[model samples]
Target: DQQVKQNSPSLSVQEGRISILNCDYTNSMFDYFLWYKKYPAEGPTFLISISSIKDKNEDGRFTVFLNKSAKHLSLHIVPSQPGDSAVYFCAASAPHTGNQFYFGTGTSLTVIP
Candidate 1:
């Protein structure tokens, strides 16, 4: 059973617009934090993140928000650019899982120039 799932498989946005990607999880105990993963050809790397204890976290044009009650996580990219086009995945690690992480299916975002 998949614990995490992306709301959309893909999304498109015009340049300079905001692109929002969302993830939902079935597990309520995943209260550590949420991380965005951008996988290259080889492996996934950290993109952005937000703490489970907080509602929002922003870094440059990237922002991540957590809705604890809804078990949802959203990643927002303002002024979406072609360079930002990628498949983004959400990951969550429970306190009991140690360093292990469960990842959701990716949401591919296309930023039109």
Candidate 2:
């Protein structure tokens, strides 16, 4: 079974709108959740993260909500901009995994100006 999955591979939204990306995990041991944004060939840049102890975390235009009980998490971007068009990956890691991170396939967001 896949440990992590993002059902929607892509999303399109007009500028200044809200863009939401969702992710689901099968591993119950995952305690650290993170969101990363990537452009074309570049490495993903960390956007926001929520620890297992917390249900939500936000940074400027980015917000991440974690539902541990449901093994689900979502990333919300408000007032999306054309520059925000990129692939977003949801990642999770267990403390015992020793710094290893597992990433979902990713959700590509296109913000039209």
Evaluated at residue 87, the lDDT of candidate 2 is 98
In angstroms, the error of model 1 at 8 is 0.7
Alpha-carbon local distance difference test for all models: 0.85, 0.94
Residue 91 deviation, candidate 2, in Å?
Answer: 0.4
lDDT tens digits, residue span 1-113, model 2: 56889999999999999999999999899999889999998999989999999998889988899998899999999989999999999999997888789999999999999
TM-score of every model versus the real structure:
0.92, 0.96
Report backbone clashes per prediction: 0, 0
Candidate 2, run of 10 with poorest lDDT: 91-100
Writing each residue's lDDT as its tens digit, candidate 1 over 11-110 gives: 9999999999999988898875555556467476788877678899899998999999999989889989998888898988888878888899899888
Please report the candidate that would top lDDT against the real structure: 2
Per-residue lDDT for 33 in model 1?
56
Mark the regions of model 1 whose C-alpha exceeds 4 Å error after superposition.
Answer: 37-40
The positional error of residue 70 in candidate 1, measured at the CA in angstroms, is 0.5
Clashing pairs in 1: none
